[model samples]
Target: MKRIFTGGTILTMAENKQVEAVYVEDNVIKAVGTLAECREAAGSGYQTVDLNGRCMMPGFVDTHTHPMMLGMCRIWADLDYPKVAGIDDLIRVLKEHGKTLPAGEAIRGYAFDQRNFKERRHPTAADLDQVSTDVYVQIMHASGHCNVVNTKLLRAIGVTDETPDPPGGALGRDKDGKPNGQLFDSANDLLSGLDGVQPQNHGPNIHMPDSPDHLMQRFEVGQDFFVRAGITTVNEVQLTKQELNTYLRARDQGKLKMRMEMSFLSNYLDDVIALGFNSTFGDNWLTIGSIKFYSDASLLSGTANVSTGYLDSDRHEGYNYHEPEEMIEILVKAHKNRLHTLTHATGDGAVDPIIDAIEKAQAEDPWPEAIHRVEHAGLVTEEQAIRMGKLGMIPSTQPEFLYLYGDGVVDAIGEEKGREFMPMARFKKYCSLYTISSDAPVTTPNPMEAISTAVTRRTNEGTVLCPEQAITVEDGLKAYTIYAARTLRRSHIAGSIEVGKLADFAILSESPLDLKEDEIQRMRDIKVMETWLDGEKIYEKK
Candidate 1:
């Protein structure tokens, strides 16, 4: 039972993008209107807290995210690719950052785009080893499907030319069939066995620190980071069995603080089916969300399986990680098991087949409220967008990506198709558009930043990648809040500030939708005066 959140301009995001302060009780928003109305409704028994005329809104729900990757903030090396001018610049960055770590320790970095670099090629192990033969290092390409490691690092991890490649992953090799120290999705097996990668100080596994009492510690810290950015929930994509078990153990212990709709990796379909679980199969804080399958390489890593070629180079054509038939098979299996299926679909070319596959599976056995998702449905055809809406599929997109990668899209997908980047308006006209967070160690989990970007559709100076696609600030706000909740099928309880909805909201310095776009960006690091999850104050900015 709580009292009052008064004197703040609240963005309810319910029906209209209404503004008001609210009163709460029994862990739900009891009333919303002017401050006097809430205070009067609350009475003397209510615990009163004034917001001093700031913004109070439903916490943002990021539909796509990976919180564990936050450890990368402390552990891995980031190549800073988007900022680099050329290959020589990347080499310089590696040489500088490699000097401060343990001698044999590897350098790992993320967020590099081949389109922006002069070399237009990822740096391999030899490139890294040349600077420091003693150190082992790996740089994950922006695509997230692959990364390149140095010889020292790969050898130390025991990846050799003779080692057979792991399923669903690739070990990039060079002249004469020698491993070139580049690994794609298959890198999981290659890195998992290496205790060195998890961090020796934490435990046998060097990458995942062992000192935390439970995984919830990681979740909470990650949640705070998200709240500060105004993100209320996240669709944490791709969980393995062990990872799912960890989340369960943490939740049972009451460690998870934010709302999470976690997805299952397609590889584990058989195991999940044997257990008899399907999509939207759990409670408020945790649940068995969509099942994940890959359609294309990550957009940042420069492979999106498009019919067109990359603007940077002729050889660098886009590609899909999974075969069309195999993808259809996954959808069929998931549909049969009654689990909702969501895949990573990004290219215009991939759109037709991906949708066709979904249609094929559904045509035989329809999922009555399937609530399927297409991750990064960035460059979809007009017909495909319409079909998605008609068929009840959700386009789980990253608005933040449009803000960050708009320029890169032009270089990576060519001008003709590049203009198709996150054309949300057209999609909204034809499909059910949804927004969620894809976060660290991917993109940041900040909803305010996401809100600003979504509305502005900001790109590199002098270049508006798709200005016509820009959404209203109010719509952008909902994309992260209510729209996000709907994507997770959690709208019944969370999403907006209304009776019976959980009292989960963030206190901000000012209303984001009211402030000028430029001011909104400068409002970075704004404090959350308080955060309530289940009618309880779990976090209050110190």
Candidate 2:
């Protein structure tokens, strides 16, 4: 059936910008133009869907996300604070949640940031002991870099004081040299039911394979979260074999409501090459993205490899997951196999190796058309940006950092440096690609809020970190839409509202483009009235 949506300002995102109506037939857009023209083309067989003079645009495409983890957060014990003030409050909440769990079930908690705790430190085994001694309780940090478990868990998992730390991870120790039950990076792999050691060539235990049904359950939860935020498409940043199976099963069961592009981890580069998978391996619904390599740790935990290190009395430079030689080797091999790379390098320290590797890889075998990306690009310098642009590399960045963690960044690395932490202006001037994402579960997946952060560069405290770095509203919108779709190489089918493209759209309460700079911050208040996928109304605000 053909449908005509009228009485609205349609921001097609095409060169023309605005249109009066959009006509859809099945899962593709038929036309976008004046209401009278669209109505005439529709004839009497079409149904009219009134937009009530609201605004409609291309659906948001989140180019980076961890769907499984996001879903797990929904099902697990949420220890995320301001709700739970301190260590005691966290234990109390966990204890209360534990009561609801079935017998013999391991208590799992998520989104626990020690930075927000009054104690201002990681929770140790003793701290968690107050919650439960018998149960093996595990609480993951909000950054997803590490976890703190109880002694019971350590004992149950057979990790002792004598246990050696993994190559890229460390086990926190007490003053007496005993295991403090705090695990960082690869150390958390001990809980993944793997070899209890880091994978041979992998970064950590990111390959937590689960049953297909379990994946479906988790996908259902995460899908709803993204859909509500008006995200019709997502680029799953890191996918293992298990994730591959989960996505396949979900698609087979018709559970995949949004378009997904999966980028397998760099650890599995051998397997990817052996399988002969290329960038265009899958269909539009689920496609191969790029090979993701973890170059360093999280910035929130101060584990990110920064060149100048932390600006404090006791200056300490963070560590990298792999040596420069090792990183170069991985990048070269992946590039040789015709797979694009997406290296996660947040700090200036880690960024060097990644840039070096990419430059070397391109120099050896230049694939200028292949879009190699740098995730986070959090502490990139102007020189690095220039190198990236010259290499035709893209920075897959998250602007929500400004909204949620801007203050923390300022606190760690002085206000002057923090002002340019994620420099949007410099990135534009250097790199041609301007992709932005939520990095959800790290921060919420609200595109409007993400855009607000980009346009304002303001933190939750209302402090504008860098007014000069602030991007325009149009740039923010394009970052989330066209640029994001370009990241996955799906701009032809997705991205903007154009004829002969997928009729994926988001209906907003107001036109963000028509708003003032001050009003752009309030874009979060503009409700997502409806989200459409494949020309079907998947989400409607009540």
Candidate 3:
């Protein structure tokens, strides 16, 4: 079927291009130019879709998020701000939730940030014990890098005072040297016990299982979060066996809607290579894009391997997941096998080793087109940016971090370093392209929030962390659309509203470019009027 989209500002997202109308046929863009030209291209027997003065652009491509986890979070107790204000509120909320669960079921809560608490401290086992000592209670930090379990769960997991810290992860201890129920990074694996989902030591363990039917429901719920927010594509950056199975089930059942590029955990590196799997292993809807590695823990958790210590002594300097040589060896193996890599590195300390490994990998076996990404690349130096530019690395970062946690970051890292957080402008200067994403379930999956944060550099409290690092609104949109598509190597097929590209589009209530600097915060208020994929309207505002 042929359709001509008219009466809207069509943002092609290709070198600041805009058109009065877009001509589509059989789910692909056939032409884009003046309304008359598009109508002429459409010929007869075509449909006219009136946009009514809205703005049309490429659907957002969220390059990093955990859809399964995001869905699972929906079922868990939401402890995000304004929901639970402090430890007392957290305990009260958990107790209320505990009453609703049946016996033998673990009570899982997520999105609790201690920074928002009046006490400004993690809820220890003692605090969680107030909820229920009879059942297993675990609350995950907003960063997903840490978890605080009740004493019962600690004992159930067999983590004792004598149990030494796991390599690449740590157990928070009290003044008496006893485990305090705080598990960081690899230590989160202990929560899985003997039969639960284990990611090995590749990354944090958050893939707790549920019934297959319930998991499928969760996947669908998560997909809605993206589609409603104008995101048509996403990169599941931490794909585990369970997540892969879920995706397969969703695909086979015809329930999967969003275009997904899966980045399997490094734990599967050997198996992937043995199977001769590369980035092009799957179809457009579900492709194997990269091998994901964790160089360090999360920056928001105050555990992102920074060179300098945090201001608070209690928040110790973070540690790397692997030694420099070991990381280099692993990266080299993947690089040699012609597999793309995405390593989570949120601090200079974490970013440096990844830089070294990529440098070594390229020197050993050069793949000029290889775009190994530094996930987060949150706190990078100018020199490191220069090196990353030369290596053709993609700094896949989340600008929403600034909008949500900028003040807390400043409080943790101090003023100077915090001001340089994310540094999208510097990245634009050196790197060929930088992509912005919502590490969703961490912030929000809404691209408008990210774009607002990127262009304004404003925190939740309206403080500009680094105004110098702010990019133009158009650039921010490009980062979430075209640049992000490039990161997934799908720009030709999905990114822009150009000839021969898929008809995936997001229609907004107003053009974001029309918002003045002072009205930048209003960007988040711009609603996604409709979202289309494959020339079909998938979502429309009620």
Candidate 4:
């Protein structure tokens, strides 16, 4: 229904920087100016909702997220790295968990990165074995690219000492050719061939294939959580054309409230080419984003492909997992397919090479219209930042990551490496970077926490990582809104409170612009009163 929302402070994020009450007609914004102007624009049939002095801003457009993984959030034994400490602590926690379980059950846990630990060592099968032999287990590291398995799990999966390392992954065996119960980034990919493992013993430990219901539930729960935090949009990554269609179905059926933009997984670049899908193939509700690729794993896993061997481990040098030639081939393929490649490169050594591939694409024939997007563009050099901006690539980042990982980064990579950080001030002034999600179980999708961190540059413990990297709150707002719209290629349609734009925005209980430094850091003060998408009230505070 067409509506008028009045008596609210507004952050229009428009080119002219105007702020006012707005009138929504059907699915688009009919007007945004003074309250009188908005009321006048709305005819007799329109509904008026009072915003009660709350602030209205463009919906946050998260440029990178994994909506399906969110359904797996509380399903596993939550072995978050920050919760458990040493191996002993991990064992104790698992032993405690094992005691509560029946015999021969797997103690499954995800998001347990060893890099967050003081020792920076992987959790091994020996560790869980000490807890319970019958308690075969597999745990996902925080990087989401690796896992550790118990001997029983290995045996169940038919992984032997002599089992040749599968293509693109390692079995991680130790002396005398015994599987070490540890796996790296590509290791999970190899396990895809092994026996399926399910949460608990939910019937013979099968890996159930993801279905429409599985994905849709995640979208529902994930989107609900976002609306409560005043987020209006999320640009989810790791989607195929089929998955993309699922989200479209949600929008069409009126089940989806959050405005969505999705990045297609690079695995189906061929399908994208055959279908001839462009960047903005769908409506503002759900549009196609860049094609997501992973050059290497995150910094936490030693597989991040860094220039120097980590100072702590001499035997291990980060692998450039995406070989230069391989990267070139895939990148060239993406260019030919007319899809922008959004790569996840979180190490110093990986950045330049990926950029080189992009450079090659630009020089070659039939390059995609835009060379945009680098997901989790962490550990980048100043030169790379300059090069990325010049190339028009958006760096989708998670500030909450800085909140938790900042300390570990300094300890692992040294102060010099940690100092580079998100480079918010630098990006605001010099680059075309914007904020997106990296979500449900990776980190909270709250934009305000990101907004606070973006402005404060404060690490998790309130220690300032790089004071120079802080951007103003105003610009940070833009990063999550209009700049994000630019990332989704929906700038003209939904980013700002323009008259012709979609009536999609979030109503916040607290006006962040009016808050002080310490106030934003509190987080609880920033609350959502309501969320409207496509001129329809999708969520209302009960």
Query: Number of the top candidate by lDDT?
Result: 3
Candidate 1, 75: how far from true, in Å? 2.8
Task: Please write out the lDDT profile of model 4 over residues 1-542, one tens digit for every residue.
Answer: 77887776888888657566788888888888887887787867878778788888877777766665554554556677567766777777777776676777667666776766666778777787776677567777666656788888777767776777543345566656777887665556434453332111000111223466766775676667776665667776777544566677887788876767777666666667788876647775677746767776667656666675466543266655557788777877777666766777777777876777777778786454575666777777778888877766667777667776777666667787776667777666557656646455577667887777777777876688888888877887888888887777777876688888877888888688887776767653487777877776677788
Backbone clashes under 3 angstroms, per model: 25, 0, 0, 1
Candidate 2's displacement at residue 212, Å, is: 3.7
- Badly placed stretches (over 4 Å) of model 2 are 195-201, 204-211, 311-315
Q: Write the per-residue lDDT of candidate 3 for residues 172-288, one digit (tens) a residue.
A: 989899999999899988877677677756899988767788878888888899999989999999988788899999999888888999998998999989988897788878999
TM-score for candidate 4: 0.89
| TM-scores of all candidate predictions against the true structure | 0.87, 0.96, 0.98, 0.89
RMSD each, Å: 4.5, 1.9, 1.2, 4.3
State the lDDT of candidate 2 residue by residue for 420-466, as single tens digits: 87899888888888788977778878888888888888888788877
Residue 39 of model 4 has an lDDT of 74
The superposed Cα distance between candidate 3 and the true structure at residue 121, in angstroms, equals 0.9
* Best-fitting candidate, scored by TM-score: 3
